[model samples]
Target: MSDSDPVKGKYAAFFRGCPVEAELLLSDIDSERIFDSIADALTETGYIVLPAALPLGISDALFTRIASFEDDVFRPAGVGRAAEFQLNPFVRNDEIRWLSSGDEVEAQYLAWMEKLRVGLNRRLFMGLFDYECHFARYMPGAFYKKHVDAFKGRTNRVLSTVFYLNPNWAVDDGGHLVMYEDSVEPIAKISPLMGTLVVFLSDRFPHEVTTASRLRYSIAGWFRVNTNLGPHIDPPQ
Candidate 1:
């Protein structure tokens, strides 16, 4: 995970012209400081928004991987999971492809998140067991209405993460993630800009994705704690 490391050559080319491109590895960057900031933010505020948080090497690879996918590879995103799953266009109108280790780029992203999971557990003792995420694509005009990622006791998801991949996003591009508090006024209106990572307590925030004026891409995921349901220990799906 260094500049001279063999693995760096494979993904480094992708970052050449990107605005946030720094070809930084987790080791090259101040990962410890980043982790500390995330922990402190979660303890004081329910959410944290970070700009250019991901190392450029992996971020570029992720952008390329998602951009290469064909339309057929993505399915309509749905509500709920397992037996309760259903496509509710009124609630969410995006497309998705679940992330898996089968692909190198996706695996790299997952590995990066693993570092986060472990770091947070050590700092906040959040008991995060694992993570699952998907590549979400919102074409022009797509939107997801206000909703919480999880309910306190009804789900295992404890933290939610959104990492954006849209470069040079304009202020009026319209794809802002509006986060609300108890009184209905928004606490933040986050732009889905490149390399911006948002982390929040899943059950404590209500958020919605405003309609996008152009195509949008992001990796949205959750850190889940182990929950038992007879023989099953995770998502029943």
Candidate 2:
């Protein structure tokens, strides 16, 4: 079946930032169906949200596995600073520590992510050449400053997908995902909902993670194409 065969509609105005919000309104979208809808949505809105995309049990399992690696993650200071402010745990090679830990739970999580990649391409018309997954953990008071995922000479980062895993999260707990609307003054906030997938244009949106009162965990990464890339390359400066 094609993307048009499934549900289609404009999401709330809040989601329609300067870029786009292409949403699939299906009650139960299987992996293949989701892939198609996502691809179509990306073409128009530069992003899409898949609510309840995965089973709750599976989602819980994935988050549990991530929590197991709290110590193994290479936590680095200097994340949120104007030049360097907060702490960050970035796994660059995917061959050390947590990635190489080989715990059953971690293995299961990787397998599920691989399955997601296959589904995305088969269902959404995306090429699976340089796609990768990265896990993120934000402790209480931790925040990621606003920044674009794509850099000049490294435009292969076509899209960014974030799967929020914080269950029973409250507004007072903070750590909301904030995206500036059209590079304007007022910003839009998206609550971190369990099992909800947020996809958006990697190059266009300047976004950041607000400080959290409690621990916040999520699987955040980008979809990319193969290209020789450069480091910290500013857009025009």
Candidate 3:
């Protein structure tokens, strides 16, 4: 889509807080050309949602490949009072093997990451970005409490991105992504649409994954800066 697209104008306002919901921007954007426009929107607001970023067929293929390794994945803990499932490819434990496993999914993830990095750099004037993919499966009643992606000793994470893989999700599905913006009240809720991509600032906002009525599949990850130092960078307040 061109910069002059009405969706672009709507997104500019949405990001600036003139519009409270993102559905306003989706009206004029073509799902097929979402990559570029969404990138532009993200540059100003630190977040963007492309209503239909992928086709059903491609989304299904990618989800199938991700599900094939369910048993080998390691789930996260300590974020909530109750058990909330999370799979991380960058975990420090031995239980989680082969970060990418050199599989077709890994290759696809790498390519997608490259494209995201290019878009981010072009729009936000940021460069040298890196990322890792993690699959999250939330079953009925499972939920992730509010938390920030970057913590007290880590700030290398520049942005966080999540691609929803579930199909036919509805408002009653209960798997919306809740984000707390600059205010203490009025949280933002994003629908978990198949092929929909959500990007946002990794350190500035606190977010959570709500309970699911059924199974919820998503590729949740972060983009970081490559540095000679380790993973203990100071967190941004």
Candidate 4:
């Protein structure tokens, strides 16, 4: 943040004497501006697609981390949750490895997301309790059928986010995320370019990944509200 930053500038006096944790971020990235824009777009259109949104260094580091993983680290992705989870290759052919802060690079990415969660909560007034994410890899010819991340009051997932890590991606790469509304025709087709970020209401749009010509990489995450009450939990142990 700079002396001329609008978010910090506008709230400087209001947040004067506040603890360092109160601030959105201490990173060199323009997080305040980017997060504010995301909040605004989500408010107006329920979704927003940003190209090259992340800082170059962080993006490159994340890409390197996921790319260096061994094949055995990932497991075939499945539908549903916990006991309801089951593999079906027809629905999705990709593999994923859940993210955790134990690793340095993964911790860095999650730290940024934690800041984003706070920013969105402050702006949107939503009870976003936490976030969970995974690295998804679509190998050559792999694809995922259209599906929504959440369904109204049934799921804890409130907002979904996807960050692309494929550097030097081309239009002919053949792996595009297609979003849909009420119409049968798709509304948007997004290329998996490095540093691109996509955010949307988890229940609002049905989306799918097209067949990949080569390896496609991305981080898929969700902001969730706590659903733990007494004997029942959102994710059963």
Candidate 5:
């Protein structure tokens, strides 16, 4: 509200003195521009990166919440459908816990994602019906092998998203997401920096998480179409 408040909120250097209420910096995103960019990228290369997608306040709060959790709160991430799911550290060594509409910050983030889903659907006619996400933590020396988020003719996951929460990430941090646009080379190598958001076609991009020297945090999610019916569901995962 005050000029001083904005200055203090912007520089978050002294967390002990700055009030939490002052940190709720609402997003000032241009919806039309953002969705248009996303659509264009999807049409061209099948992915897009939106730096500082969420306001610094929301991203900071979400990161704090995830960092405050106990080690047991996250389970070793696995792959495949319900019964077919198995833990194979060689594939992905990170730990994860699905996000739910409980805490205030979590609710706000989910609502924002819903708005994104609706906006993209309207502009790009993506037919996105729902969104799901989980908080993931990769410990030191952990990594995920190159893989696609969705398989052809098998799942309803249409879009994949990754929002990074690690602050002050350095070039040597080693947790870069390398996405392959072609068979022989990568199109992008992204750092898991604070407030960064990456969205890509689930089945189009082949990506992998390189080893991290220190702990890394992020929220990985997907947008899906309604494929469930009376007696059967598309995917039980």
Candidate 6:
């Protein structure tokens, strides 16, 4: 569409005049390009990792806020949902605190993810209906065994997204996210570096976190379709 087209012109004006959320998204052309790249990568492979995908300031603020949370605020990472949910440290040895719009960084990050959800839907026609995420901390020696985020036709979580929060991370840190294909060999090993974002098809790739020698921090999230089963819902609990 030409810039002079009335509909296109109206959107251009609206982009400039919209609120903070729109301003944060529409004003950053690079982010749009990044989203396109992410979509393309997911289509080509099952996953993609982008370094420095998020604004540095937002990543810093989120890391700081999560670090400040009281010890009790985080619960042992578990598998399953609601009644079936139970702590399974053998599978994953980490702690988690769910994300909410309770703080400035949390709110900003949610807004950012919302913008991403919209962008992905527009580009790929994924019908992503909602998103939910949590702040996760992996203490020394913590690790998660290989697993897929969702079961095909049993869950609505279609896409998984992870944002790392550890700056100055090293290869020795050992908390690399290892993704596997059909074979035993891993296809990708990703470091938990600050501002790095990873996106993937939830049920297509099996992945794990290697044991970390030091504290590891990240935001793990999913974009879900609105599929209902009886009175039960996706996201389980």
The local lDDT score (0 to 100) that residue 114 gets in candidate 3 is 56
- Residue-by-residue lDDT tens digits, candidate 5, 97-192: 988755667765775676678678878898887788999999999999999888876889989999999999998999999999667698899999
Q: Which ten residues in a row have the lowest lDDT in candidate 4?
A: 19-28
- TM-score against native, each model: 0.87, 0.67, 0.68, 0.86, 0.85, 0.87
Per-residue C-alpha lDDT of model 6 across residues 35-54, encoded as one tens digit per residue: 88988997888788999887
Model 5: residues >4 Å from true position, as ranges? 1-29, 228-236
Q: Which stretches of candidate 1 lie over 4 Å from their true place?
A: 1-29, 229-232
Count backbone clashes in candidate 5: 0
Candidate 4 lDDT, 38-93, residue by residue in tens: 99999998899989676676689899998999999999999988778999999998
CA-lDDT, candidates in order? 0.85, 0.60, 0.62, 0.84, 0.82, 0.84
> Deviation in angstroms for 168 in model 6?
1.0
| Model 2 misplaced stretches (Cα beyond 4 Å) | 1-29, 70-74, 77-104, 107-126, 185-187, 228-237
TM for candidate 3 is 0.68
lDDT against true structure, model 4: 0.84
**C-alpha positional error of residue 25 in candidate 3 after TM-score superposition, expressed in Å:** 25
Give the clash count for each candidate. Answer: 0, 9, 0, 0, 0, 0
TM-score for predicted model 5 compared with the true structure: 0.85
For candidate 3, lDDT tens digit of each residue in 58-107? 46866786566665474543331124434532321112222352454444
lDDT of candidate model 2 versus the reference:
0.60
- Model 1 C-alpha lDDT per residue in residues 1-237, reported as the tens digit of each score: 456643344445533442342334434447768888999999999889999777787788899999999999999999998888999999999999999865767766775677688789999999887789999999999999999999879889999999999988998888899999787899999999999999999999999999999999999999999888577677633
Candidate order (lDDT) = 1, 4, 6, 5, 3, 2
Q: Candidate 3: lDDT of 133?
A: 60
Evaluation by TM-score, superior candidate among 3 and 4: 4
lDDT value for model 6: 0.84
Candidate 1 global CA lDDT score:
0.85
